[model samples]
Target: MKNNFFYGYSKQADLPEKKRLLFTEFMKNNVKINQADSATLLTGVLAPPAAMAAKKAGESLPQLKMIKNVPDVLFVPSATVVALITVRFSKRLFMRN
Candidate 1:
């Protein structure tokens, strides 16, 4: 339907079954990454239902690999707690500069 978020993609035909899927797509592929406006840079969003339905219909879609959370994450986070990440570089690398 014209109102569908993926109307244009759905209308495409004669494409390789694998390439016809709508998963991750660039927002502005023609724009150079380094030169394009940061605000209009490429982006993509998930349409899981669409992909799943396509797979059920026997269309060959790119295999989606789902990442399961660490098995060690058995304990649920507290309401007031937030997960944090830290990146540490080698002391030798910074010292050389």
Candidate 2:
């Protein structure tokens, strides 16, 4: 039973590297300053390369169009603990911009 519960939570489990990737992607993809005109907020795990790329692009990264301005449309490589941070930090995203 404990294992089952733990397994159920696996989707939310995030490796340190995984969290770093998603955070990096979020910082890279969402560079818009205006809430009304910026891309959707993003969060979650990213493929190793994706994160590396995002880190490379840094603050100069471009915006994405897949999701609307809702912000929940994060580009995660897979499921992770990022949901919590993304859910709340979604609003904080544009502030720095």
Candidate 3:
């Protein structure tokens, strides 16, 4: 029960690195920010590389999307933690900008 709850919660803050990379890459190629227009709002888990790329490209991503990132019993602990932090901090930075 606890594990399930944590898994659900974590999905809101983290995503698989490959998915993050692809989502941000797609946005980078498609989103354009103009001063007169409000920036597009995206909610998704963003890894460090994806966030940095989006930042440099002037894209706005608000938070981690509620995407599934299932944690294996013994394999995904550390990566999940890092991804959570990356997504949160990146969202903060994007919001600030």
Candidate 4:
């Protein structure tokens, strides 16, 4: 039987030193980006529904009249920004040693 170039390198530890380092760095960056992207997506998805609920609730309360008058186009971006900042701030606050 003939052996392929990658036949024995099944695990990351089996990779050459330089390649292993590069792979590890790539994975770390990928995970960080994935987490950021997930947060952004979650905020984006939740913002609209939240705005709608607020608008509905505001209709029955004089104190929330400002919420009822705000347009969705403006509300969504602002809500997303606030949500992302909250997520990042809370992570920093609680994830410390």
Top model number, TM-score: 4
Could you give candidate 1's per-residue lDDT for residues 18-90 as a string of tens digits? 3344323434433456543322221111223333343444433344222122121332222112111101123
**lDDT tens digits by residue: candidate 4, 1-97:** 7543243345545458856776576567556543455765787688677866766777789877777678878876777777778877777787794
The best-first sequence of candidates by lDDT reads 4, 3, 2, 1
To one decimal, what is the Cα RMSD in angstroms of model 4 from the true structure? 10.8
By lDDT, the best candidate is 4
- Per-residue lDDT tens digits for candidate 3, residues 16-54, read 775566556667877898532122222223333454453
Residue 48 lDDT in model 4?
70
TM-score of each: 0.19, 0.20, 0.25, 0.51
Ten-residue stretch with the least lDDT total in model 1: 79-88
Order the numbered candidates by TM-score, best leading.
4, 3, 2, 1
| Model 4, TM vs. native | 0.51
Local distance difference test, each candidate: 0.33, 0.46, 0.47, 0.69
Residue pairs that clash (backbone atoms under 3 angstroms), model 4: none
Model 3: colliding residue pairs: 44-63, 44-64, 44-65, 45-64, 45-65
Q: State the weakest 10-residue window (summed lDDT) of model 2.
A: 36-45
Clashing pairs in 2: 41-71, 42-74, 45-77
Point out where model 1 deviates above 4 Å.
1-5, 16-81, 85-97
Clashes of each: 0, 3, 5, 0
